[model samples]
Target: MSGWSDSGWGLRMQSWGEKYNQSNLGSPDCVSSSDTISRPTLWAEPSPVVPKGADVTLRCQGQRGRNRFQLWKDGELQEERNTSWHLAEFVLREVDDWRDARSYRCRSGQGPLWSELSDPLALVVMTGDFPKPSIAVSPSPSVLAWTTVTIQCQISSQQSSPDYNFALLEAKSLQVLQLQSLSRSQPYFSLPFVRAEDTGSYGCIYYRKTPPYKGSHPSHTVKLTVSGPLPKPTLWAQPGLVVAQGTNITLWCSRPSLASSEEVTYTLLKTGTWQPLRNQNATDLWTDFSLPSVRPEDTGSYRCTYKDRTASGAQSETSEALELMVTGSLPKPSLSALPGQVVEPGKHVTLQCRQPLQPELWRATFILLKVGSLQPLQSQRPVGTSAVFPLLSVRAQDAGNYTCVYKKTFFHQVSEPSDVLEIWVTDASPKPSLSAWPVSEIASGTNVTLLCQGPPWTTRFVLHKEGSMDIIQDEAKFFLTRVTSKHSGRYSCSYQLGTNGSLWTQHSDPLQLTVKVSSNTLLITLSCVIFLLLCFLLLVCFCHQYIPRAADFRGNSFRRFFCCSCLSQDVCLSHHLEDPKEETLYTEVAKERPKESSVPIDKDVTYAHLNIKNLNERQTNPKETSTEATLYATLSLD
Candidate 1:
């Protein structure tokens, strides 16, 4: 065995061994044999230190024998193969503070068997500062009450044999809340029931669990804010009240949560139906819904909801339902009249209509029509229930039928027409005129009819005859059955008016009706004349004796004699005319000659004296003649 070195020690050992053998052994054989036998030598190379993470190789060479080489690191053997010339290499995979600087050696089995350990291989790995841990919240900034949220911390670089510790801090107060060790590069922390007071900025710090426990920079901060619950809402109505049908109604929705500058949309609900009101962007406390025309079907309970433009969520609450009741429609009406269906012209008539129960909301109108025609005679609206139509002087045109109708305020409903009424009018009749059919030839017992004609409008004709009290009334014409002496009279006719309480017209011009006598009638009249004459003769005879003498009382006896002679000449006339005259004359004579007178004498003497007196007066008036004297003598006869 020999020590390993790079110097020439084996040649010096041969020179000295030859000189010592010549002196000590004193034999030529001893010197020659020692010089012929050889000695072993050893050598090592590249013995300086190497840097960490650098590749290193060791080699061992030996002389004059088969040798084995071995390599060692920090007193521990590394695996290698046997050979006289040996070589080994290694790469440094990791280095720490203590293991970064260490020595390595190589040894041989023969020729002194070992080499001194090599210089230290100092490894200085390039180290830099760790990156800051990144922090983040799970649900961003929105964390509700009693809800869990996650916080995460992550390091940029990882180590092979890494150990990690984590610390959490509030950014506002710098107060630590949690500290723990973890083996992973990224760690997570859970926070629950975050309150308003718990709301703040937060950050995390991470470090490796080594000798120095070097910490990484803090993460970026994040902020969070918590809010409370919203307030309740209210709703109401506009115009504040409801009334009868056809009235306009309005409803309003309001809320206290409405901000002055915020817009709000309102929804009006009725019986599960929803409607949007006007002014959806209004900030006022209420919104309105106008119902221009309301009816019974429109009535219902109502509520509302509101949404603010700036609110995170909609605020809503149900209101007390308001009940609306609307009045119903009016009823149909009825029309009537006084003296109902029958009316007379030239008289007063009244029409009436009865409205429904609500009379204030309705009115009536009357229409008068011709019986069979659609043309209206009159149309009128009366303030009261009854209206009167007066016909002062009625004519045929005034007669007609009439009816009435009633209507509601809105004109949407009307009543059936009233029962029809009829009117009748009348005109005055004319006087009738009469005429004889045959002018000059009417005989007794002849059949004749006195045709009495009146006005065409006359309903009844009345006939009258002069000097008679009987009246014959007929239609238009009058007839006399037989013409007789009794029927010979003036005939006339008149007409009767065909109206209530009407009077008859005046009588017409009279017509004369003459009857001629027959031959038998003429004979009977002559007989009557002869018989009356005979009766007169007998009366004259009886009155003659009673009469006194006329000559004794007469101063103008001749004039008297002539009148008596004229009367005596016609005995028949004397019979009818002389009796009353003779009586009157005798009365005068008897008065002239009283019974006590002395002048009394014989009849002849009285007569002579009268004759002498008459002669004397005749002589004085020569107009007297002898015929006159004879008339005197005849007058003296009783």
Candidate 2:
């Protein structure tokens, strides 16, 4: 048997064309009797590659109006059809005989005069078991609606010919989606802007392009799923989705109230990705998709779906979107605590985060991160130079290592992490005891030592002056050397159990210190008192020696008078000393004409005495006797 390309088929077509031209004697609708009809197109329905027992339709396409079509195989007419339509189709039944693998052609005309033979259409029958071609989809098999999807059919390089024909068929209906005669350069079938209607299982087949066209077995089916149909599955992340770089997390995909016996599989989907990010088979209703050490590139919106393992392969709707953020793009911010990192319970503490002061960082959100937590503890925009997070009435559980970062609204860019700031919250019970050495009241130019006593486990001590931000740390003693008036204030002290521990004992009672006169001034005041005492003693001795009448007088009367005079002088001197404006001494001498004649007037001796007088007033005494003659003298030391 000869094929369509054999010389026999060419001669048969040539003779028919000559005879048809000769017999076209009178045709009213024909433009001219010598005019020859145009050659038609012949092609196989579905594809040239067919299964062993499958039937295929051969179509001859030509001009309209009672077109006469003839289908030939191996240069012999197999069938003919006369129809008013532009094309005629003939069914080839049970193409199982490998011996009948031959070329096919068709022709169409008005009648006696026929058009030239159409191009040869090869018939491929699956007789020998040929290896199946591998099929794969670009990006992914599961696609979003209105996105382009590509199906690639791949065979071995040895099997790849110049004109290999590839056909993509839907598995359910066994309908060909696309058929292309391709070279090695173009081997894939593309479905542009696919929709929900395009969702189904698909397979591909390949065949030789020439006569005796051998066909390969169908490839494994690939399920094409378009999202948004079926019931949506629930998706959540374990340990949270927002994570730092290198953090591991799991995405859970589950169908609500799913039957325990139903086999299910889960798929993880990320936005902007055409294929499923991950797949997992589950014996139960849910499955976990673990992403270990995720990077910045992994940050995106994610969703999940659950599909039954049944024959229908029904897939559930996509879950609500969850955002995965991997921060570390900008620069880490600084974190600090107000008051101190170690705080007493019942006290309010503020955590301040200072972000980089870049022009693009304005209004950037600051996030407070805890070491063991997957989510941010708090977030805020900077109000001033730094973002402040207040922890009111802080409890013991609030103690932990924390960091901070800033995120810009532009592209959601995040900064690197700041240094960790650990907050310690304790009861600060069993208050320490504070005491001052010597005295709380210290004069200037003296050392004031404060001692703090705490539990036996204490390793460090701290002294805090009231209304002061300066903190003085020491072992047990805090010394203020050469303290001035500025150091005179209320002070308190606390102790720490360990050298590096953030916990602290409650502050001790405040000790107030009063600083007085300087050491030099105190010395001067003592010298003045000593000098005054010496002057008084010298005056008393001089008066006793100068009075010679004291030995002559046998009676106690004169001695008493002298003693009384001396006592009165003491009172006058004390009065004069109180005058701050002037320093003056007044002397009065009483000369007695000797109540006894033996008491001669010691004219060679002078008597020194003190007289009491008011400077603002002067008076003259008229009663004057030799026994009470008074002489007055004044001395002034300015």
Candidate 3:
């Protein structure tokens, strides 16, 4: 409006007509042209980044012109203007960002002497991606093996027709794993049937489609983890996780019915590291990894994974973590169900747990537990590792599993649970039984141990010899470190409940611990040799009798009884029972016994007489009787 008026209308019309013809002419259009024309330069305000449906300005500027300007988009006429200053700006409104209607050019004229068209300028529409696109996995970072997952990569720019491409890469290995290109219609990728190897962190990048095709920096990394498919094993720590220094505890890893009878190997793993703590191949129902002694450094989270020969021989999924909160400053003590593990209903049961400790820890606070329960049943600050929890008149409900732990009042540190112990309150805690080993006529001097066995529930025991009740024992086995004749007395044992030692059950049936003199090997050998010599002499005498002596020399009935009795009374009594008059002792003794004595005492008769004598002596003095056989000397003056 401010420039020259239309007073040059005739000239302007002539100029417009001539300029329009020149505008059509280009370097490519002319084979050989006449007049040279100076061209106006064309450019866009913001290069290559025009947004869709946003207004854009294409300007053509040069020396003051005839004020006639025209704009063309991608070889098509857009608009024309008669302008004011030496510059002409053609405003393009509502231009589509991705609609290829972008390339533009302009021409300007000053009557009759018009300039050729300006250079073509291209505009690219973009929203964002000035930096890079961000990619993220849907659902969660952790996914189960063999499941589908979705990863969405998003750039701020939403181009109608995208000219930028995106590439997804694995951040872990820095591998170029393209999920999908941003230039594509869809930017999100679905990972179907994911696997262990698929677990890793990922990132995405965007690049231009134009020449040079520049690429932006990678996006922030996203983590994805895939867990294997397997039944997790059960993990429980014996003597518990929080423990004292030098305390031995076992971590039991169990996969019951699944293991069948085949042996399985179990490995215990700690968090923050791929390495395992220990492993053991177990043939039994469960495998155990023993921490023979734990130190403060051993505290951490623990889990167990195992592999068996059968059903999915591969290692199982890692079990849930069991936090080991070791505190050496805390006190640890042993736990036991005392008097015994089994107690009769209406009997006092004492759970006594103790561990040896220094005198400094005598006042440690103790806590007893019926596992799976949070509250401890017994809490006492005892003097020493020993903690006694007594239940009076225990009922069936009182019977269950129990364990204990200790803590110091000052630091509030706690020890781990002790080994599991069971309290079995049953129908009249049955009396324990007794038995001897070896099942033989025990040789004197050889060590003989009488086992006093009770139920697993019972703990305390007292053993009594038949004659002496004053001697008592706390152990189940009564070992006569050495045995003599005096030890041949009946023994019985009694057990009780409660640490208070207020009550006891009936005594076990008596078991006699017998010792014998027959154990003397040299005496036995000498007796055998003498008997053989006597037999030979008797044979000679008998043969001599056949030559010239009386009938009394050839046969004497008591001979058998006398000769066998010389060995030992126990042997004599045993043989005497088989027959009264017919049983003989030795062959020589049977031949000479009647000749030696005027009384015709058979083997049985002699045994009966000896039994009578022993009975008499026992009744009178309670002392063992000694027997002697009278041997008469037949002296021949020859």
**Counting only residues 3 or more apart in sequence or on different chains, how many pairs clash (N, Cα, C under 3 Å) in candidate 3?**
19
Please list the residue runs of candidate 1 whose C-alpha ends up more than 4 Å from where it truly belongs after superposition: 1-345, 348-428, 438-441, 455-459, 475-477, 499-502, 527-638
By summed lDDT, which 10 consecutive residues of candidate 1 come out lowest? Answer: 1-10
Clashing pairs in 2: 330-414, 330-415
Instruction: Mark the regions of model 2 whose C-alpha exceeds 4 Å error after superposition.
Output: 1-257, 272-275, 309-322, 381-385, 409-412, 428-638
Better of 2 and 3 by TM-score: 2
Q: What is the descending lDDT order?
A: 2, 3, 1
Q: 515-608, model 2: which lDDT tens digit per residue?
A: 8887788889999999999998976874454333324323234444555466665653454345443223223244433355565554455445
Badly placed stretches (over 4 Å) of model 3 are: 1-294, 300-328, 331-342, 346-403, 408-439, 442-638
Ten-residue stretch with the least lDDT total in model 2: 1-10
lDDT of 1 by residue, 1-638 (tens): 00111221111112222222211111112222222122211111111122223333334333335355555655677754566343333434444334533334445455555544332221212123556678888876766645566777776655323465565555533333444456566677666554333345677765443323344546788765434332334555444333356778776666552212245666666764545433355766666777777775565566666654553443445565654433344343344445533334455455454555455643455333344542335556777654454445455565555544443323333344455555444333334677666552487766666666754445676778777874646555555555678888777876665443255667888878887777787899999999999988876564443334454455234333434443453552454344553233332234466566576554443232133455677789888664433223223332
- Local error of candidate 3 at residue 513 (angstroms): 7.7
- The Cα local distance difference test for each model comes to 0.48, 0.66, 0.60
Q: What is the TM-score of each candidate against the true structure?
A: 0.19, 0.31, 0.26
- Give the Cα error of residue 306 in candidate 3, in Å: 17
